[model samples]
Target: MVLFLKRMLLASLLFLLAGCGQTAAPALPTKEKAMKVQIEINASVPNKQPTKLTLQRQDLVHKLYTTISALPVVTDPNRPCTMELGPRYTLIFTEADEKTLIEAEAQRYGCRPVIIQGERQQRDTNPEFWKLLDQVLREAAPPATVQKLALLHNGQTALIDSAQQAQALYDALIKLPPVPEGDPHQPEKQSAYQITFFTAHGTLSGTIDKQYARLEGNEQARGGSYYVNDAFMQQVQDISKSAHYAPGRPDALTVTVSGPEISMRSFIDTQSEDAPIMQQLYTKITRLPQKAASCSTEEEKRQKKLTTTSLHFTQWGLPLLSVEIYEGEHCQQVLPGPGSEVQPDDEFWNLLHKLNR
Candidate 1:
């Protein structure tokens, strides 16, 4: 099943280049045209993971539109001119002739223009689909969800009441999936699920007898289960016994749950500071749902890369729902903070209360 999806994705990408609007060649203007635009990103932000490209664009205006459309931060694509990413962030457009369309797009997306030295020569373009995706991801954060979140007033930085809000906003921004390219007719297919849920208790450790059977944590305070693979369960037991840590109260426990149906799994032990158990759980949960072919050469080395699966949770944190994804590895944890808002339009206090608790 996983191999079938991989083959389908490859085939869809080829069809996208030949037929779809995503990678179609730019329509040549009736008259001769020459414009040059170059987009350079810092790429290296401290303590941040590398951003992946999602889609490509040839024309500046279309590129901007494509970028906005691909953004995962924007919950409502139709919402007019919502800028939730950052204040100092600049969208540099080095066009020879003033292109009102692209500039208008920048303004609409809450991005500003910075003049750079270069000829606005028209060339083949593949806009950074990943960075734009990060922008749309901020919708779930506090500064975005709060009653009167700080709007971008002029200049490079937007003011917020606390650093936590900024970090939360960044977190939401970065967690978006890459913009998919290929034939829209052929639906995207996901490989197996390899999800890991971590906490502070290492109480339950054993190999399960079957695949898709529930593996529950032992302690009452830290009990949860998901349909997982038999081989994955064995691997967890082996890793746990080999792992050696100074035995105090277990500060963090991680459970590795893998299969075709697992999503993001996590256990927040308010009791402990270090979450080694949770770390191991994350490692397993992210890996179990993947196939051998999906593991990249690098991931094969560490044996801990997870596929790009959806992160769905059970209401009130019970019986979490797991979804499959394309084969890739990422580290994303979504633990509701103290004062975490239950709904999208709740007070910021809900977030504070959850994270602090």
Candidate 2:
């Protein structure tokens, strides 16, 4: 009986070990499922102070809904746009589409403009819309802040200490000089600060350097600001040369897709031996996937689609992954092979650290 009992215990232990061995880490999305994007704008505003703008869902669809609700009069769609300031000075767009009209109107009115998909039935002022509009009006109206600066490397983000810092940085961004018109090395103005955030999908480059801060609108402009170092700028240039780099005109960001089946998970890895606070960023980045999806849908003809989120840190000299998803037939564009899954590699992280420092 003693021998039998011992054998039973041994069997139980073996079964438990097998179960443990089979356990796997929680699943993360693949790169093929994600889409990478960036937004950039150049502006010249009257106020030097940073302006805060939010997208208004109501105002953007004014042409369609206003006619239905009998609020504002609808005009010919093919006429030229005539913009005027004041309560009565009407803003018009002759050739503007919904997106262009929204952006242009927002810039002219000094309010955050949101693009609404539907119509409004009533005329009552939306408390949130007025609040946002009022806040924008009362604050600075600096022009040309980056709507988005997507990294050639996709799906990356940079973590600030707090929302306040994020606001501060954003507010201060407009006063900074424009990103040099030419190569980063030969720009007419140099950046006061430039840092790149890396993620599994790609990277994000941020600049708040002195030349940018000295704009006419900025009352709080500083004389001696530290911008990105030469090595760092060169690194940015080098990354742009990769096969993935996509060029842009004055107002759009250049996106580069470095590798297939890219991972956006690095944006969330706060396990830095250097910055403990970065770990908390992992939790904050949960919205990354949703944010990426905000502006994109499955491209009708594209073979594959991916949603990616990424963040990089020059401060800690590390990059973290956040989220990645794979979709469609051509997702293999970033994938290794037919059935291979996405996995994190140390090689990219090492390169990020080297370039950032």
Candidate 3:
């Protein structure tokens, strides 16, 4: 059940947004027919025995499946992991008739893999996913549930107060699989994001990096960096952006170009003759496909050098959001913040150039 307090006009609008012109999310399989999932655990922490479990809730299974499905896909077999084989688990998806649909070997300790049985080395699973599964396994045993929930990032504070929204967001979060790391020891100075949740009891939060690798902590926690992959953060971000935009779209957007070969200039406001073109440009940016979770300006000296452009979304002439884009060949991505980045489609660049002309 969705659980959290509700207040403020924006929260109210957020609820109405379900049917208020907001795009409907893809529907999940019917619970009664496909919610039955079998989970197997081997040598979990503090235990040496293997155990069997089942998940019948449509909502739970749906969240788990969808979350992992959203992670960045990779073809490489090698991933960064701590090599702790102590914790091993498997999840079996089946129909009401017990017909198996898919099987997954879940590891939160080592490679943090949620690999489909027999598949090559590829994983979208992360420690957070394993942690969530751990909680689910524990919950299936009996009872479980979190604290003041909020998304802390990029100089903004948005409280996840609604029960439905909070539950959905957290559910989406844990479903994200962990990424493989090269060193499992290479440490990033900062995580760039902290997603907190409201349990029925207190609270638990995760500090996340661009690769989606994370660490569990309380308020003001930092995360570990493993790889450079994100797109998942967009889910977390758009959730906040959706709620924030509920009151109104930004009054204006600014596109400023600054790179090794160009002088910095700004295109402010879009209410003139080229308004339609400007709107398309704005939409292209807002809907730009994300790549890395974030990029840290603090680590600029250590990051790969690149040429890029920047954009700023503002309301009443005040900055609301900002992003930097690298259109170069090295790592063409939209940088959302310190340590987080995203990939934009050709449309983004084409529109950018068109508008610039």
* Best model per TM-score: 3
Q: Point out the higher-scoring one by TM-score: 2 or 3.
A: 3
lDDT value, residue 183 of candidate 2: 29
Which model, 2 or 3, shows the larger lDDT? 3
User: How many pairs collide in each candidate, listed in order?
Assistant: 53, 61, 25
* Cα lDDT computed for each candidate against the true fold: 0.30, 0.31, 0.56
Ranking by TM-score: 3, 2, 1
At residue 72, candidate 2 shows an lDDT of 26
Model 2, C-alpha of 312: deviation from truth (Å): 4.7
TM-score of each: 0.19, 0.21, 0.31
Residues 116-215 of candidate 1 have per-residue lDDT tens digits of: 1231321221245434423322211112122111211111112234434423422332232322333143321321221122223222221122333221
Q: Which 10-residue window in model 3 sums to the lowest lDDT?
A: 217-226
Candidate 1: residue 87 Cα off by (Å): 11
**Native-to-model Cα distance after best TM-score fit, residue 91 in candidate 1, in Å:** 4.4
Between prediction 1 and prediction 2, the one with superior lDDT is 2
For model 3, residues 29-55, the per-residue Cα lDDT tens digits are 443455567877676547345666677
Which candidate model has the greater lDDT, 1 or 3? 3
User: Ten-residue segment with the worst summed lDDT in candidate 2?
Assistant: 247-256
